[model samples]
Target: MSILLVEDEAPKRKNIRSLLEQMDLLGLVSEACSVGSAIRSLRSSSFDLILLDMSLPTFDIVAGESGGRAQGFGGVEVLRYMDRFKLPTAVIVVTAYPAFSQGDKEIDLTELGKNLEAQHPKIFRGIVFYNSMFSTWRDELKTKIEEVIIR
Candidate 1:
């Protein structure tokens, strides 16, 4: 039961991987850098939980940070993409999208959870937030991943 980690930053990815290993979860941590890689990973293997980075470099992170993309995507784009799957793999969109309250049409965490649970059932576990500057989220993700793995 691997925990798929889809993040682009080397430092953050390393730090998160370290924490997961510390929790006796090294074998359960898999990494990916982009949407294509992530999708491929999902297709080729099975993961208990997906620790995603909502701010993918796909839409030009530079442009997204500077406010340019039409979709205003960061991590939520992953969620929107998940919704399209007829046999969608279970997913959790780990992101830092701003102004994405529960009411917004955009891909919010609460909505994403509901969608995954409702649409994908057991395969779609849940989500965990990512904090680039801190390892707290990494530890928290380890706990969440453990729950799914143990189940």
Candidate 2:
């Protein structure tokens, strides 16, 4: 199955890739580090699954330049784009943050997941909180992937 991984942090991306490799499910895996790059990939290719991070830079980071402003709900934007285009790809948010700002208030991951599912039910599969210190996220991700595969 084709998979698109959208994450800005190098270490996290590496870890996720390693996990996918371990699962032996790394078929046609594409990586994108920013909102723009992720969107471009979505436009050009079709993916069975997308492992997304909640926050991302506006564009890909250059060697000497900082990537543009970071979007707190970047994964949401990507989901919206997929919904707009009626893409059949499913998304599982792999976020490091437990909560993020939404306007003036903070929204927890659970609430964000519910909102996303409500807004884009067709493509929003679920959310997986990632913490490098714990192995739970790895198991959770594996379960989610297995579910997708069975579907």
Candidate 3:
């Protein structure tokens, strides 16, 4: 499967990429560190799944400066960009947002799952994959790929 992983953290990004490599599933995994880069990559190629981060720091340079905005947001903007720009790609919110109140030293994947379901019910093909801090990328992902490809 062609997987596009969009993340901004070094550790989490490396961990997930390593996991994919270990699982022999990094064949078509494209890495993007921000929403803009991911959007550009999406415009150039097609991917089967998009592993998105819920918190992204996007920028818009207007002049010689190399900065725009450093907001603590992610997937919501990415989705909004996709819809506004008419980019056709499936996304999976693999975030650690609902895992806590945004970095409070606590975790709650269950609540995250419920919120994902409620907000993304129409996106049935999307997977609310666990946060980057939460390890374990199983061969079950391969199974899911098979099911999706077959359909």
Candidate 4:
């Protein structure tokens, strides 16, 4: 299956790509490092699944520059874009953050997951909490990917 991985951090993105390669599920994998790049990719190609990072920069950072504003709900914005265009791609949010601020209110990952599933049921598959120090996230991600593959 074709997959789009949207992650701003190079290390995390490399880890995810390595995991997918190890799992032998790296079919037509594409990478996007920011909200703008992700959206541009979405507009240009069709993906069977999207592994998204919740927090992301508004645009990609150049090699020698780093002044772009970050968006706490960048993945959510991608989902909104999918919903708006009625894209049928399944999404699995992979984030390192435990909580995020929505306007003035801070919501935990659980609430955010529930809200995302409820609001974008058509494309939202699940959320996986990722920590480089832990292996549980890898297992959870494997399970989620298998579930999506089965469906």
Scored by TM-score, the top model is 2
lDDT of each: 0.63, 0.91, 0.64, 0.92
TM-scores, in order shown?
0.63, 0.97, 0.66, 0.95
Candidate 1 has a TM-score of 0.63
Candidate 2 CA-lDDT value:
0.91
- In candidate 2, stretches whose alpha carbon ends up further than 4 angstroms from where it belongs are none
The best-first sequence of candidates by lDDT reads 4, 2, 3, 1
In model 3, the runs with Cα more than 4 Å from the true position are 60-67, 99-151
Better of 3 and 4 by TM-score: 4
* Model 3 vs. true fold: TM: 0.66
Tens-place lDDT per residue, model 4, 1-151, is 9999999998999889989998897767999988889999999999999999999998899878672888888888899999999999999999999898878899998999999989999999999999999899999999999899999
Residue-pair clashes, model 2? 0
lDDT of 2 by residue, 1-151 (tens): 9999999999899989989999997766999999999999999998999999989998999898688988998888888889889998989999999999978999998999899889998888899999999989999999998898889
How does candidate 2 fare on TM-score? 0.97
What would the C-alpha RMSD of candidate 3 be, to one decimal place?
4.9
* Candidate 1 global lDDT: 0.63
For model 4 the TM-score comes to 0.95
